[model samples]
Target: MSEKDTTNTSIEENVITLQTAQEWAARWRENPLNTVKAHLIPRVDINELLAEKYVVDIRAYIGVDDQGVNKLMLVGVDAAGNDLINASNGDYIYDFTQPCPNTCDVDSPLYTLKP
Candidate 1:
């Protein structure tokens, strides 16, 4: 895929903001998986595809929509939080893996805060 297409697939926005705990709670109510635990991988073995070359970290947050499509945004943050990448449908599998796809680069526009 073209670089543009790859970016389009990874970038997303969180409708909820981190103003207060109440707001955070409201956001979570909309999407239960918005909690940190939801983004975490209990067993690294499940991530066999990552091998040793790639390091995975989890981050989570709540997302809200006017239409009531609240979502839990679980993202995989690299060693550096700036290098955030969205997990693939709660699954980390990729069609192919390399040093890191251009989409995975820290400077890619696809990078964003978990929530």
Candidate 2:
């Protein structure tokens, strides 16, 4: 098999979607370390729920770290409970030791209550 085919195998194994990839890219830009922490929660099952609920299959959940760095890792299993592989671009992986050039664009909550 060619390199492209090899790469595709990993991608297929790690069934990530475009929207999920974009979210990960955004998170990487916002906070690198926090992104890592978010991935640490074992109960947050991305593969199971996404496969059961959404039409699109999710192989991995991408996010940023506290240092405002982008990164992607295999954190969940497939619908068949197979281990995921890294299918993202190599150059896109952000260094978590550096400061984020841009702030997170997550929308603020519209409501606020005074205690």
lDDT of 2 by residue, 36-85 (tens): 22222122233333443222433444555344454454333445755443
Off by over 4 Å in 2: 1-11, 32-62, 65-70, 73-115
Which pairs of residues clash in candidate 1, taking residues 3 or more apart in a chain or in different chains? Answer: none
Cα deviation of 1, candidate 1, in Å:
36
Q: Report the poorest 10 consecutive residues by lDDT, candidate 2.
A: 91-100
- Report every candidate's CA lDDT: 0.35, 0.37
Residue 51, model 2: lDDT of: 42
TM-score of each: 0.28, 0.23
Q: Per-residue lDDT for 1-115 in model 1, tens only?
A: 1133222232122212234323544765766653232221223232432332344664454544344433344434566663233244333322211112222444545344443
